[model samples]
Target: MTTPNSFLVISALGKDRPGIVNALSKKILDDGCNIADSRMTVLGGEFAILLLVEGQWNTLAKLENALPELEQELDLTIITKRTEERTPSSNLLPYAVDVVAMDHPGIVNHLAEFFSQRSINIEDMMTSSYAAPHTGTPMFAVHMNVGIPSDLHIAGLRDEFMDYCDGLNLDAVLEPVKG
Candidate 1:
């Protein structure tokens, strides 16, 4: 009997600057690996990158070996982990929500706390902020896709979220995720 090989997920974090992507992608290309999916962003002046890479199990050592030099050059922390095969979902219903408010601290933290309490899983999230040109005040926004269990009541959840939003001075809208 033989065990099956698996894909790998790579995540890197460090201060935001130029050439981070170039350095990492060069290493991947030199190792003959392919990037299946990736997301890179600058969050609060720190650069974060998440990548799903596919290659042969025998080549894993090569990929691991290439990281140290890049880490030294970019002053970054790199982590690579094997990915588990995803089981098919039967009762998964997708939900999406948008949140917008005056820029303030603890917004994401508060929303995440609420979601965790309800066992809601966030599949994807994008957050951004900008200054209003006229007033020079900041506006914040978040758009996220979440998974809702079949047992939860949507109306009750909405009401609960509304109360929280009122307290935070934020506006939230929840809707079904459509393809």
Candidate 2:
């Protein structure tokens, strides 16, 4: 049997623009690397990409070399680090939380602070806003998929969040994440 290859994580950040993916993928392809998984998105005005890749150990140099040109061409930062495989956690349960409120600052910061205090793991989060009809004011919304520890008290967490939300003049909802 063949030995399993190790994986590398690549993270890239730059101004939002086209061709970032094409350039990055071309480099990976040239280096004979395979992408295991990746996440790419435009956050505010910045483009961020995270990729998990696998290939022969020595090909890492080729992968590194492939980035500088793109970095200069696109004015972005690219970083790569190796990762070790670990046994998947079977005990963790995922849940979703949705927050909607009148547009205001610090919504994300406040929510993130709360999660940080509780050591809650956010698997994914997305936030957006749109102009409310006639009012012409923006209405903000946030959706987060989080991993909740089995021992954590959901009711207590909800109460704490509600208190914070009240102070912020926002509507918050927490419910069991249904698959």
Candidate 3:
């Protein structure tokens, strides 16, 4: 049995600071809302926040109304929308892809294009640029979690992707992610 509830997916962006999350979480508690799941990170000088908030219908409404004050006070930009809690898919196979190469433009773009052409779904991705270990040359790395349809041929996909990476001068590996 499922209980009746409401969910709000929120994204907030603003200058990084000491108290932004604390303030928001405290306010949510005061408004009788619960934090369902969240990921917060700092990108350069700015902070990015994404969270799913759960509560009853009326309390969720009240929290929504109360947010304008925080937006104005913190000079933050916020976007919120009602959302459904999604269950994980059992029909797709999880695969991990990692790439390392000289920091160059179009690497991520080309990778995205390749996956999009195959109708692949990217679940999550993380990328970073740093100095090479031996030399001081800039290096880029990307790790992504992609969902391949169960009907897709993993061997063919792996072979084609490796060839594509070789053409791009990128070192890449694709392997199944553990359950």
Candidate 4:
């Protein structure tokens, strides 16, 4: 029988440069591991990458063993952890939340508090700050994928969330995430 596939999460950080992705992906491929999911971006002067890799147990182990050498060669800080495939919850419905407002501290913390108090789970989120057009005023934007419990009252939740956003002077939208 074929060996069962195992999963590994790899995160790397380094000074921003070209060819990092090429080198890393090449190493993964050469070690017989496949990248299942990845997020790569530059923040400030740093390059950051997060990858979920899949392979047979031995193959993953081989990649793990080679990581230290690769880290030195690429001048990156590498971290790895073993994981299992995620089993999504059936009682949750996916929704999207968007917010844009004047750049300020506490926006994310407040949003998290709101969701946390409601027992909602935030699956993925991204936030950015930029200058608004014409005015060059600092502005912040957030996009989040959340899993709301199916039993929650949608209309009530929407009304409450809108009111909450209004109280915070945030422009926001809440809607189901289209598949």
For this target, which candidate reaches the highest TM-score against the unseen true structure?
Answer: 4
Distance (Å) between predicted and true CA of 130, model 4? Answer: 0.6
Model 2, stretches more than 4 Å misplaced? none
State which candidate has the highest lDDT.
Answer: 4
List per-prediction Cα lDDT, in the order shown: 0.86, 0.84, 0.92, 0.96
* Candidate 2 to truth, TM: 0.81
Candidate 1's C-alpha runs over 4 A off are 1-5, 15-18, 73-75
| Per-model TM against the reference | 0.83, 0.81, 0.92, 0.97
- Rank candidates, TM-score, best first: 4, 3, 1, 2
Clashes of each: 0, 0, 0, 0
Model 2 C-alpha lDDT per residue in residues 1-179, reported as the tens digit of each score: 86576778999999888888998888888888888888888988999999988887767667877777877887988787888765656666677889998898988998888888888878789899988889888899999987777788888878988898888888888777886
User: How big is the positional error of residue 164 in model 1, measured in Å on the Cα after superposition?
Assistant: 2.7
Tell me the tens digit of each residue's lDDT in model 3 across 49-137: 99899999888899999898998988899899999878788988999999999999999998999899998998889899999878999
RMSD of 2: 2.5
Better of 1 and 2 by TM-score: 1
Native RMSD of candidate 4 (Å)? 0.9
Q: After superposing candidate 3, which stretches have Cα over 4 Å from the reference?
A: none
lDDT value, candidate 3, whole model: 0.92
Question: Measured by TM-score, how close is model 1 to the native structure?
Answer: 0.83
